[model samples]
Target chain A: MAGSSVSWSERAVRLLRRMNSFYSAGSSRCQCWHFSVGGMEVGLVPPAVLKQLRRFPEVFSFKEEKRLELNPGLASYHDRSSAVDRVLQRLREEERFTCLQGWRDEKYEVMPQFSDPPLMCMERAATSLFGVKRYGVHVNGFTRQPDGQLAMWVARRSLSKQTYPGLLDNMVAGGIGSQKGIRDTLIKECAEEASIPECIAAAARPVGTVSYTYEDGEGVFAECQFVFDLEVSSDFSPSVGDGEVHQFYLWPIEKVKDALVTEEFKQNCALVVLDFLIRHSYLHPDTEPNYLELVVGLHRPL
Target chain B: MAGSSVSWSERAVRLLRRMNSFYSAGSSRCQCWHFSVGGMEVGLVPPAVLKQLRRFPEVFSFKEEKRLELNPGLASYHDRSSAVDRVLQRLREEERFTCLQGWRDEKYEVMPQFSDPPLMCMERAATSLFGVKRYGVHVNGFTRQPDGQLAMWVARRSLSKQTYPGLLDNMVAGGIGSQKGIRDTLIKECAEEASIPECIAAAARPVGTVSYTYEDGEGVFAECQFVFDLEVSSDFSPSVGDGEVHQFYLWPIEKVKDALVTEEFKQNCALVVLDFLIRHSYLHPDTEPNYLELVVGLHRPL
Candidate 1:
């Protein structure tokens, strides 16, 4: 697929910069106060969140200069989880935050790092409000044609989905809830979203991750998606199972590359596809001037 | 083939952190002054380099407070290159920097980013002294065995080599000179170092990159390696063409993973192989707790 007058690499980098805007120097969110718990910086609190947080003086603190700290007195993980949950429930009832309207009743772990012990857990919808790190697994489904060319399976999100409705997504994607592990979530999502059998889904390979942080009206979103690539037989097709995905289309890799710069795919999902293109040697250094930048952008520290 | 007491993921992260020690919090080099060229921050100048730069007032200016800027008066690329070259030549003759002992006639472009127009060119050996970004091509030579298992071809550097002598290296690697392009250099290096034919080398897939910045006693080292994965036919074996490599070993994937923690490979080459493992699903999120961190560390901003 031929790129536009402006190379696809340039457009891809622009999209990545937008996704990582919060971390860019001189961005307004870069001025946001640090959100810390147990003296560990876990998230970023925007100005609006900071103001609202001031209302819960016993639960949140801004006493340490430009930092918002959870009450260190909430010693155990359960105590901290309950303390924050109480505040979120009050905010939901008061309709103080719009993000709470899409609450999935799911919880995400809050920790300094992914491998670290959880400091607390927060509602899935409320994660962006606190700018806590969110983790998910995204599967890149593809198959090899008889002509020896590769094609990717792209999913159009159901119009009824709560977030990013009707947008293009990977074949299977789901957040890793506090109660679930990465692999379990991945395999479960594959079967539920794409109707792929557990045996085939189990063969999906974990191929590193893509991470970025950006801030919007809702709050700040810092996320990392564990990426996987699954190659299925030519005759295999993924049909919608749970209706989260409206439709699945198997398109040539060339067509997928053309769509990448259009921003047609969900932002993070576009990154997953971009990583696939690079790994598969489609977006090469010889032709893509922004190759290195794209690589770094996809793997930013969460 | 088993990891030692420590998990391979932890050891890999520890090694990556060591390679990227300069960017970690509280590192001495983090306190170094920014080295700017043509109004762009292209490098980092440590205190030792700063002290020596004071000898050439006409070319370098550090009066800006915690920033080292090449004389703005040297406007054109040739002018800047010549001025910097004069000073470097002086340093070489006066034996001011021990790193110059391994001087390479090759020159590296000084730029804010790889695709940008270079402000000037500096001797490759002096890049570390100024902490400029240096890029090279590293090929992960691997092949699929008849049993469906994978193995990697690892090279042992000649003892006479100037840098990292007698250490393990990738099958093929070479720095990208200012005048040569990425693909040409990669193809050339593959042929020169491993005696790979042009047709075979042309099939190498440009997977991605591994970048890091570290500061040692000599100076700040910031570098990025353009990574390529070349899956040679099982019948094809790479032979040493250049004396830079003393021998080559084709090790099982499991053995390669085991050696990753020993630090037996050249620091950067180990990273290239580790990246290979992740890309091919050998190091997985299901088992590697540091999966995301390893992904981020391998692609740090240079």
Candidate 2:
């Protein structure tokens, strides 16, 4: 077992070297990851495992490099070296290990497959690889009602998951994992999170793709996000998904500003969705020139 | 001998797979190499090798890919994989047989240090990879001259080269692989090709990067180009590199346009360089509004 662990460590190092060589040759900028978030220690995560974490925000934050540590529970799995070692160890030692059978069940619908080592590496390093593909619709304008202004639909995430859990997120944000297209993911996630009908989701037009990197206490995460803006009636009501979401709310452009400024909205959720709104002129640029500029400028680099 | 050939072929396949996987995962868009250019076959050059080509286009294009096919004496090297296999067999048969020592010494300066199997495979496959990198820059209007016309510095590429040899190209243009930084490469190439002094090159402001894929009989090629717009005095005289260039001329915007359209300048060279001028409004937008719009819109999708 010790010899096997040593071999796995050597293999992990080799994989990392290959990855580094590939990245260095290309011009695309790469972000680094530290394992833990805030005051947590996450050193148990192998460097190769942590390397994959750089792609998702739910798991990593580049800006929080120094504070990145390991999850304490991962210490037992440290010497295992290979990902398979850890998985097999868990199966033998834990009662709930049998429940993890779903991870290997290819027969299950909508479940991710983990048969390939490199792919499994991507899955275990969940945050960076969790870019959900979705369709974006840019609505031109909205009308104000007596009580509130009518605009398109958007959603806030349930805080239970990882990173920015309870924050207001995309109107329809999702991760584009293996075997899923952006359009299909959008439709599925929107339906699950907002109770939006599949037909309406299908009608959503894609504007373009926006990629960004966000770092926090978790680890450095990258997102190749698809932004969609949709127009719904003023009388429309939202039904939140009990499984994926905590609640849903409709805000006028004015109220959105307050929600965004306060901690109500997730990191840049308001900015990205609002930028799409202003670019298509869905909201009056004059009322919130500063917000429009901020959002639009965020899409561009200096 | 047959075993060695099979091993080399397997290595080539492995390298190709790795290249394909890397590009698909990271780049915005990528096209596979399926055509041969000059003497080289396609889909053999790895990203590192491609980057090497971009750096020293003069050496790589002139000596490596270009000379291998265009030079009749070297034409014997063109039997594809079978020819490579035979060459390896010959090297094995004659223990003292060293492979092209003279050619190796000549190309050593520009050739990147790569490993054996992949490097050998790249040499045999004759493939080229091309793509675009976006270096976004904001351009303001250009200054006009006292002669009642817009004065522009037209650059001439080194004459001792391939493709539009000795003709005017851009205010400045060079391959990205010339050096580490785009700014540094542009400065060096401009200084060498057009005789723009180091002091002036230092002041040049970057406009943007233009990426394009070009394929001819030689091979598939990709270029990540950076263009800059600098203000030069109307009376500014350039000291051209006599060995590589004949002279440099500062022309009125009108003469430049006529030269570009009439093929008085090299074909497409005028169109591309002139398009940059128009897109940035260095030329009068009202008089050439259509031309301006066309060029600006050309880069929108990219």
Candidate 3:
């Protein structure tokens, strides 16, 4: 929030504020419905989504903070049982909302559970007004040459894809769907996106994450990407196993950096690449002007 | 700032807030000097330090946001010039201030400039009353057995050392001193702390960083450790190259994890090891409940 000699323009500030805003700033003025967990408001989802939830009267209730509560009593109908997910699926299909990313078992992380599992995953939560946490895994695939040069395998999304059609992507990237955990989803994506074998896929290191809560056209996006790095043998070559990606290109690290400056890479993939460059020593505090700001800004506070 | 079901006690909250309070939390009420870069206020330092800083009026000045600017003109001195360092040295020698961590050429990292080097190194800016970014290299030293079980080499600081005496530490850790760049400093520390040869030290991969701003009796500390991971050969044994370490112990990663929960490891070393654990897949997201949090919290914003 503190501006310095940087001197960002009003337009740039507004764009940044739009991309980084978590709850609608000055939410008190907005007629929004709060999304709560264990009686605390985490977010204020769009009111239209609340209107749709009216059908499930027994599952949700309104209270303080203009809050909408997911009743603990509904735990009996875990989404795994197709109870609540079934209702959301019906709404997606019947109402024909464009936001539904299909009937995948997407689990929206709610509260922390020590010994036991979370009460339930928020199925179809991303497109909802709720500020439920969604997890994803992004893998940086690279190979080191005998001469010590590093080359990364980058993916180009198919034009037919729903989001960011034909955009450039990391070697492998996918959501941590309810069907699989973070690592599992990563391994699955590695296989599906780049045909990386299971043994090699498991070698991917969980480096860290880049989290941000921004509002898009759909709703609030409180996304946290658990990043990983996979160093494939120089002899290995990747072939797309899934139709999601159009093709793969192995570019020198320098080329990747150039693309990063341009708008050639997908939005989030650029951040992942920046993280990779930092860890690999390609980028250093002394070598990067906005070193501290870039590092902290990639993982901003919600 | 929003607390949910994840509520900590007032004491725990204070401890966390103190350690992570990099940004001014509407702390405009407090009378303090702002440390800015570009046009941004990175931190607010105590006035007592400002009073001390007044001795070298050429180095720092006050402006906006109650701002104290590290004069760009002083960058020409590089703190290598005895003129500025001598004054600070004298103050440290005569004042009997508990915060001085002794004289060293600390790298005060500034903007990137390939054409010319940074203006000046921190040159012992850490223990100063003003909060400036302090950089260090923390290496997670470990060996992989034939059976694939991982064990880490832990260093016990020599009881006579200046700080955290007798406390457990990473296999190698040291400040990015003014004399050398980050990589050179790490290589030097590896040699000085663990007799690791230049060839082996070069193999250490530059990982990411972990940042935190904490307030202690020593004024305010805004620290960022450029982390590294070195997979030492199984045959190699580490011996104390200097008197900084009392002894070295090679313990199972699990044992290290157990000790992490206790006070056996120094506050910061535990975090470095945790970062290693996550990277090595020893502490996985699926098994560890605070897995996501631990990863994100380790690399805090600013």
Report the number of clashing residue pairs per model. Answer: 0, 42, 8
> Which candidate achieves the best DockQ against the true structure?
1
Question: Which candidate should be chosen as best, given lDDT against the real structure?
Answer: 1
What 10-residue stretch in candidate 2 chain B is worst by lDDT?
B107-116
How does each model score on TM-score? 0.96, 0.34, 0.73
**Lowest lDDT block of 10, candidate 1 chain A:** A1-10
DockQ of each: 0.86, 0.02, 0.29
The best-first sequence of candidates by lDDT reads: 1, 3, 2
Q: Top TM-score: which candidate number?
A: 1
Residue lDDT tens for model 1, A142-197 = 99999989999999999999898998999999999996889899889999999998
Model 2 lDDT per residue over A1-302, tens place: 23334442233223222222312344122433333422332222324344444443333444454334323333332221233334433433443322233242221111111111112222323232221111122211233466654554446577675546778766656555545555676778767767778876665544333333333232233333444545556665557775456666665665654454444666546545544444433442123323212332233210
Q: Compared with the true structure, what per-residue lDDT tens digits does model 3 show for residues A1-302?
A: 44444332222223334445654475322666767655544556666677787787766777676778777555542542344566577777775455774544556545432223444566644434565656689999999988899999899998888778888899999987555678788878988988989999998887777676676556677667888888999888778888889999999998887675444577677778877887677766554544545555556554
Global lDDT of each model? 0.90, 0.40, 0.68
The residue ranges of model 3 lying beyond 4 angstroms of the native Cα positions read: A1-34, A44-128, A142-150, A187-205, A231-238, A284-286, A298-302, B1-33, B36-42, B46-97, B100-128, B143-151, B178-180, B195-200, B234-239
Winner of 2 and 3 under TM-score: 3
What overall lDDT, based on C-alpha atoms, would model 3 receive against the true structure? 0.68
Model 1: colliding residue pairs:
none
